[model samples]
Target: MRLMPDEHQVRSLDHQWQLGNTRGQMRTWGRGQFRWTTFDLSVERGPDGKRRIKKTTLTDTADLKNPLRDAVLAMGWSWRARLSKL
Candidate 1:
């Protein structure tokens, strides 16, 4: 996926979007409607005093692919993904 950084946000053709200090969302079409999966993002300091980004998926996504995680890793940031029960 070719993600273009627009200011503090990154967007791709697949409709993956991310904003600063805010939740991100992925949109997919299914069952004659749009399905949305949200991601909660946070930045924290790691044990080494470096910044780490935490991304938590808030809902079950219709698609199995995770472009956001791939994008974050591509940016060379310390990141992790978590699955939320909610």
Candidate 2:
């Protein structure tokens, strides 16, 4: 069987969450009208004291809402907490 890479989109009513590496640790689901190429990765503690992650998409950067309304804004926030650090 042929194989293909997973896919994701920005839209409303979409809830994406994952934890992995830059190889394929992206969760994108929602609505919007922006074109994104990729998302940058970084390690930062969240306000919840859970040692959460911080995503910075290559395009959007205004606000993040599942099922996003703007492609650029849909940057990255896959509901994931952190990568496996393996």
Please report the candidate that would top lDDT against the real structure.
1
| Per-model TM-score on C-alpha atoms | 0.31, 0.25
| Candidate 1 lDDT score relative to the true structure | 0.51
Best by TM-score: 1
lDDT of 1 by residue, 5-60 (tens): 44333332333343444354453332222347889999999999999999999885
> Residue 18 in model 1: shift from native, Å?
18
Please, what are the lDDT tens digits per residue for candidate 2 over residues 1-86?
11122423322232244466778666554332333346888888777867766788775433443234343236542232222221
lDDT scores in order: 0.51, 0.42
Which residue pairs collide, candidate 1?
Answer: none
Residue-pair clashes per prediction, in order, are: 0, 10
TM-score of candidate 1 to 2 decimals = 0.31
